[model samples]
Target: MPERTSYDAVIVGGGHNGLVAAAYLARAGRSVLVLERLDHTGGAAVSTRAFAGVDARLSRYSYLVSLLPPKIVRDLGLRFAVRKRTVSSYTPAVRAGRPTGLLVGGGEARTRESFAELTGSEREFAAWQGFYGTTRRLAERVFPTLTEPLPTRAALRAAVDDDATWHALFERPLGELVEETFTDDLVRGVVLTDALIGTFAAAHDPSLRQNRCFLYHVIGGGTGDWDVPLGGMGALTDALAEAARGAGAEIVTDCAVTGLATDGRAAEVTCARGTIGARRVLVNASPRELAHLLGEDPPPPAEGAQLKVNMLLTRLPRLRDSRVDPREAFAGTFHVAEGYGQLERSYQQAASGELPAAPPSEIYCHSLTDPSILGADLVRRGYQTLTLFGLHAPARLFTADNDATRERLLAATLAELDTHLAEPLADCLARDADGRPCIEAKSPLDLDAELGLPGGNIFHRELAFPYADPEDGQGGGAPARWGVATGHPNVLLCGAGAVRGGGVSGIPGHNAAMAVLEEG
Candidate 1:
């Protein structure tokens, strides 16, 4: 028997974006086939029983949900859902030789008190409210346009309506805005963390890369709130796969795409199983992967900066600050050594080819919000999961020896975390069936090799502002209305590389499907 040799659309890579495209195109009555290299459909968005014999299922690579739009959910009839955290974030600090922390949820009054206590003034708290108020407006105006076409820089500026905000976010370095807006170093760092999640940049970088990262984080669903998926990250991908299949799209796993060819009207994709032809090809891989498949030279390389660690804890560790409960603090992002000055120093160290003496990181406990990820037995036993994202640890750091650097960096990171804990983090470790600590760490290099993320960049490349650049159409055809256009008319980028793409949002996938439909 032979597999089908053709489809109306052949999508390479089976990540959530690819799944979205398949569902839309299939629903539109186009024959769609999705090819995934891995045995599973989910790319980095997966849930796994990480430790041997562990009953807890952890969102291994990419966790949390903030960018996915409700429109996509309704349009696809997805069964996925997310729960908002009661606490936004908790940053532990030692003030006036007293162990204290700034907690940013519960209520406006409580957060204000924490801010006042930290700086001995309410100035920063007022600034926090004002800065966020401005961003909130910007988010509302800009987020709605993502699923539509890409707007020119001038149009987007006019759409934003506020010249000050447009310039602050689009034109100037994010660091300058943060420093000018917030007086407290810790508060400034808290605001800045949103800009540096998977990005490697200083606040003052002239390129404004941090600003681009900051926009996506703050504009999620127009609220900037990062919610926890009811299941693990895999659940979202699973729902996407279901929607796609139900819409009559064929999904084939373990089928690696080797090459792609197009003649401006039709395309052929070579995969491990066989070659398939299509009228249009939608790429769910990165720009580099797309170029390689098309036999074209890739652009300048991009490197991701972050260290990821997942742990199954016997119990949540106690915080140095006794006022806030561990559950409340861990439920939201737990900031460690991420003071404004500390973050800058760490970035400088990493840029100069050395590991940050004290790495900036954040921890989150998904179980507190949704216990379904853990087995009933583990839940009854008070076991929980903690995911750590360490900043300033780029792919370059582990190029020489990924294995050794991971161990050293993991140890140092945990040790730094221990300094702010009542007991060492190791004390809360849950042992697996084989007597091994139920824990794992991944550096940028590890993620690259495992997930095929070029240079370990999660967003595929440095994120560009959602709007079209001034040079967008200089190559002479109409500007990419959907931001998914490629050199060949029959091919389109449906991944994070697309304009207004990045995060778990399905904007690119939706836009790609729209492009194909409009062309047809």
Candidate 2:
């Protein structure tokens, strides 16, 4: 017979969310046990030495930080730090022998000059400021409410205090909104990319899932800025795990939870090693995974649409536009083949089961922002790390022939990158001890197989509005009262699948803890 341990609460999964929940519960003087399937914790928010014979630690999956709430960071007393990127985004648009690019957030004069070069007018730049100003206002109001009980649609709209902002973001299609606001196709694509990241949907998809994704991306801590972790993403999770352990939480790795059952008074979690019982069980897995563990019919699997590529470059690639600095261009998100028409064409192709001719992707140089990711030797050698997220490559595209499709998509993506660079990106790649280029590509299928993300969806399932939408009846029954409610009373969701639980944020974990503590 397996040994049984009793705790006040049990958290299944040791992802960032699980760790967050464990910390909060244990800190509250409740005995907690966190079970993880993997040999190591952190889930996707982890760092590893991907290249052989290289001492560089790369944030293999889920690289940047933005959505993590400040309150949780402070409340948990986490010691990790995040560094802001100087350049927001740089897009190269070389036209007829004229080398020019759109640079946002670098300098006021430079940004206006870039906009003027691209659109032949300064009005578009004014429009850009106006649009982002509105988002900033919306973020300020909505972001603070994430950690609290879910608000009704009317309450949230009233808080925003701008009818146009509410209608444009909540009711209208994001694509239509972007088109109406921005004049340049590239500018529109940049704004719309937020809606499509990790989500497989067109800008105008009536489902409005894109809008939710967009809102989350832009509302990070009310500033909508994504920052680089000081010591890779692992550092952040390590701090979280430490906080949990310090609070007397027991975290067990390589302990895959096989089954979960609740009997009103206590919840039983059966794992490979043993069974644990607790008054409350917080599920930190995807909704689909939770259903499977509970022996219930799983919901439709969420499909992840982005292809992630990690590459180590011996040196930054030279850009065709000689005016812009390569270091600055690659520092932030380097948009590649992400024009409005380009994105639409790619989406249509992927939807039809065909690979996009030019996969819309963006690349960020992590080492440029945070050199701590590299070893002294690697840094001295002028090596840098590049993480590319390819949008519109959904799970279905890889179902038939994952390897073949991955290779095709990668080649297409690289070819697209080569268009803007003076040299092929592959040529700047660092070599491993085995002479293999220090590069790897992961498809949606790979994410599912490796990280246990169902259908490789990073956000777990399709993202729903964080607040309860009663008019649409979207939020799973009684969402406005508590978004983390699992309807089982004893079980609660504390993962990305929960309401307001997408991104690297620990809102779900914090909310779940609140639910448990409130009941007591």
Instruction: Tell me the deviation in Å of residue 157 in model 2.
Output: 0.7
Best TM-score among the predictions, by candidate number: 1
lDDT of 1 at 190: 91
Q: Which stretches of candidate 2 lie over 4 Å from their true place?
A: 1-4, 97-99, 470-480
Name the lDDT value of residue 70 in candidate 1. Answer: 96
Ten contiguous residues minimizing lDDT sum, candidate 1: 470-479
- Deviation in angstroms for 278 in model 1? 0.8
TM-scores, each model vs. reference: 0.98, 0.97
Instruction: Give a tens-digit lDDT track for model 1, residues 80-173.
Output: 9999999999999998888998999999999999998898998999999999999889889998989887887888899899999998999999
lDDT string, candidate 2, 92-142, tens digits: 776667766788868888788888888889988999989988898888999
